[model samples]
Target: MSSTETVRAGSGRAGKRRTPGRAGRAHDTREAILDAAERLFAERGVGEVSNRQIGQAAGQANNFAVGYHFGTKADLVRAIVRRHTAVTEELRVRMLARIAEPGDLRAWISCLVRPATRQLDALGVPSWRARCLAQFDTVPALRRIVVEESVATPSMGRVLEGMFRLLPGLPQEVREERGDMSRLLVVHTLAERERALHAGERAGTGWEATAAGLVDALAGLWPAPVTTRPLPG
Candidate 1:
């Protein structure tokens, strides 16, 4: 090869080596920002937290660090949801694959609840994710972000599909109502347990036990017969 060609080849190899290091640093910065944002948002509602505060909490001296990395607060919330959803999705997908009976209500419900509880368990004590999600559930805009990013995933879609298949006889309106109920139940339950753990309070049981309790409660809730009220004459 010519001298010029050899030098160009060496430069190309060096660029390839440097690319990943740069990318890794950027990824680490983004993750740090996400961790700080999740904690702050959980403790103080999303509206009360600012980008500059998040930047400082993440150890970024640059005032624009959060904005540069994550754009708006809504975008940052979406990023945090996406970060955890990937892990929960994988867990749910694995559980889905092992489901033997399509009509088993508890099995389908397990797909919905266990993955999230399991993720929290994996996060260990003093986790902020469940509380972060609970906060998101309260804000209309942030809740929408959570629904779009996490709820709309393929694995979650499949979980809902399997769940609906088991409840074919349920009224459409009731099914929708129960769907909202299930979300509330799971979110609040996990958030409460997370808060307890964070405060050094006894959570009463481990995550597996919590998941089992939630599954049992949902199994009952999902299949309960709808009662009709007579209209006033």
Candidate 2:
């Protein structure tokens, strides 16, 4: 082939390759970016990492990764929140299906906590994710996503609502107050214990051991109101 013809052929191939038709590749790239962001954010803190850093962690060739896929840092935060929500949803479904009739509040609450605690156990806060969740409260965009998607999503809320119903009767204000505290206690314990375990403290025995201890501690905040059994009618 003539040199000019060879050059033209190569140019045509290059143009075709650059036609921006990599839907699957784009999807995979986006997924990788979020995975890295979550790992980093959970380990470090959202403020400690940048989009360029996230791209690097994801093994991306370009530094403009998060922008290319998610458009903004806040969007990337939402993406991570969505991933957590997805895991929570899977557990929520299991809890919903498994909670027996005449459900014990403690047992039902366990269903919600057990799966998520597993995620926390497996995660090491990886610097990025730890930092991110730590700073997560100050980030308006990210905070909203965390509460709406990651925290109070429907299934979990319903579980909490049921627990509220079974709670020892308190004034409306107190019930609401304690209800929120009880749920937060579970989340707080999971995060705090995970942090401790990451700091090299041994988690007592197995998961049941650790979780049972937590259950016992948090259970103290919620007690059934004691009253005299009414005489038979």
Candidate 3:
């Protein structure tokens, strides 16, 4: 085909997809609703938002729009978590596959650590804008949903337990505590790194350079226990 023909074909495809009213399928509407929900849930805490509110924000007729895609408010919460959780899931599967023998601490730690520590470049996570949403979320249910749907996946917990067993200098309880802390630390790091990325973009500087600096900073915070004694009272 000629270059002009190719350009026209591509534009035709794009126009059809973007014009949801003309070409929209049930799945298209479902995805659009989810896209809207993800932004709203991330921006405003779940407690502060309701099913009716989500439907309105999604440009739907009534609360039924959200219910059609996801049965309940709780279900919608899970869907939102799934949007940001996908990369972590893929990373886990790939990392775990490499450690086929299982309980391979070194390889698995990268799986456990990499998802939250680095920029999600390949995926469109920058659009979900996870860092900002997570930082602002104060609703207990949203936090609980993320923890259950994303953090508490079976393989993830299994690898963490293996890490605890392999690294026995520290008690299992402390290791578990650190594991929990690691999740919070990851979220905190993302919030700070994302803020820097935004600032750099606004300043007309390269974002990749800023991302590199953030990665180095995250490496410094990895799970080496502090043996320093507490200060004397």
Candidate 4:
């Protein structure tokens, strides 16, 4: 039995034959709602989807099921992001531990890029998470939730620290620009791949190949020379 399945509320053979109790059923409902919401938000923008649509997709007869379980759209978005990040966090921690060369820029970049690509790959085709996350960039408020749930995590912090340690000469402004650039590169690239995969179209070779390409681009991007100019008076 799965971890969630182990929470049987009744006792004896009668209990075994009995349907899942309230807690287990509620857990299942929440997961169903999350799954439906993630796909809807991915297919449509976060702002474009409604709680009623999500609840209906999840097979809930009650119109307020989404609001009851998840509260608001932002809360629902956070839940979806957290669900995926939890897995990617594990992937990143494991990748961080295996880095034999702490000074290699590509090694650190791989730590940043691979976890996300690998997570999307593991989700297989038809998964909405990457596309859903891409939509978060369209809205500032929702974007912050994405940052908090994924980029602000401890593993991500370590990856950034290691990446910056090697670029000691980078200007603060350029560093900030490169940070945003790298984030956009990773998020949209994977999202596009996910979109293609979902549509049965080609999406490069695979997630590993895609990650290698990103690591290469980022390695060069970080160390590129910056041309400073005077600010307007």
Candidate 5:
């Protein structure tokens, strides 16, 4: 039944049950659409996948179901990103509370990396969320949504503040440059591992190990000497 449909024919007990049943089914349908869209968007680029295709993959008889639930392509993408970011945000918040040493670069870097890896780990194998986000990050508009939802959060602000406090001498240009590099490294690296795990190929290590390596690299990266400064633009 569609979300708009009402079970008016039933009485009392049956009516109460059917009302909740309809809502339950609608919630299930929305999740089904999200999962289908994530996989399709990951396997095929966001521009390549149509709403009709996502609806079909989600087993929706109505071709317009995607629009009905998500409104537009950007809305759909934002929803997908929120699905993951919300979980990661919670993870980061807890990790933040555990920070005994605000000066520990590794601690703060782990705050940045481990939440994502832990979320991916909880998602199990054959997942496409990480790869879907990687694809989205390549598009400027979609990348903004990704960053707005994931990076521009209160917990993330604290993480960046904690991390940067240790590197007071780093040049602004290099800081911004390395910031971009860190994002790319974490995103693409996890996406690659997710791709490999989904493809039954060698992923080398689990999410925890991957996160540890990323944390180690980023720990070194933040403090590395800036040799050449960019010419004034």
Candidate 6:
């Protein structure tokens, strides 16, 4: 081969190697942005965090790193939520498949509660995801993103379906009310536990015990008797 042709071939090989390295760096940068954003958003409310702040926390010299990688603040929140949902979803799906009895309420409830707790446990100490989600739950715009990205998943749908099937006679209004209540209980409880753990305070048992406690509480909450009262005049 001509010397110029050999040089071009070598250049082609170098370009191929460099392309993957660049892509890998971009991936790492995006992950760093997400980690920084998650912690910041958890500590402060979502409304108080900015893209520039996230970029700075991610160690980017350029202020535009966050915006370039994740676009708006809402988009960034969704990305953070999505990062964990993929793992939690896999856990839920596996748990759902292993149910020995579909009619068992506790089993169905376990499917709902344990997957999240297990995910948090796997994430280990000082994790920000649970607290971050709790913050998102309070923001109207960001709450919608959470619902669309996390709560509306197929595994979650199956969990609700199994639970509702066992409560076939439950009043629709009461069921909806309890559903919202369950969400509040789960989100805040996990967030509080996460905070306590981060602060070096005891969380009153490990993640498994915490999951069992939540399961027991939710099982009672879901089936509690409702009394009829006259409407206020």
lDDT of 6 at 95: 97
Each prediction's RMSD to truth: 7.8, 9.3, 9.8, 6.4, 5.3, 7.4
Show model 2 residue runs off by greater than 4 Å.
1-21, 101-103, 121-141, 196-200, 224-233
**Which candidate do you rate higher for lDDT, 4 or 6?**
6
lDDT of each: 0.84, 0.63, 0.58, 0.83, 0.87, 0.85
Q: Which stretches of candidate 6 lie over 4 Å from their true place?
A: 1-20, 229-233
TM-score winner between 3 and 6, please give it: 6
Query: For this target, which candidate reaches the highest TM-score against the unseen true structure?
Result: 5
**lDDT (tens digit, per residue) of candidate 2 on 1-233:** 23321112223322423225555565676778888887777677778888889888887756665666676687677777676667768877777777786357677567556766666555544323433454565566666776776667778777767666776465565566665676556555555665666666665544456577766665566664545545559
Q: Give the TM-score of candidate 5.
A: 0.89
TM-score of each: 0.87, 0.70, 0.65, 0.88, 0.89, 0.88
When sorted by lDDT, best at the front, the candidate numbers are 5, 6, 1, 4, 2, 3
For model 6, residues 70-140, the per-residue Cα lDDT tens digits are 66788788889899888889999999999999978999999989989999998999999999999999988
Overall local distance difference test of candidate 1: 0.84
User: How far does residue 191 in candidate 2 sit from its true spot (Å)?
Assistant: 2.9
Query: What's the ranking of the predictions by TM-score, best on top?
Result: 5, 6, 4, 1, 2, 3
Judged by lDDT, which candidate is best? Answer: 5
| Candidate 5 residue lDDT tens string, 57-160 | 99887777777777779999998999878789999999999999887999999999999999999999989998999999899999999999999999999999
Candidate 4: tens digits of C-alpha lDDT, residues 1-233: 24543323234223323344566676787899999988888888887888889988998776776777666788878888888788889999999999999999899899899988888788887788888888887789998999998999999999999989999999888898888888888889888888788778875588898889889998998899888668859
Model 6 vs. true fold: TM? 0.88
Model 3: residues with Cα > 4 Å off, grouped in runs: 1-24, 84-87, 99-106, 116-119, 124-126, 132-138, 198-233
- Whole-structure CA lDDT of model 4: 0.83
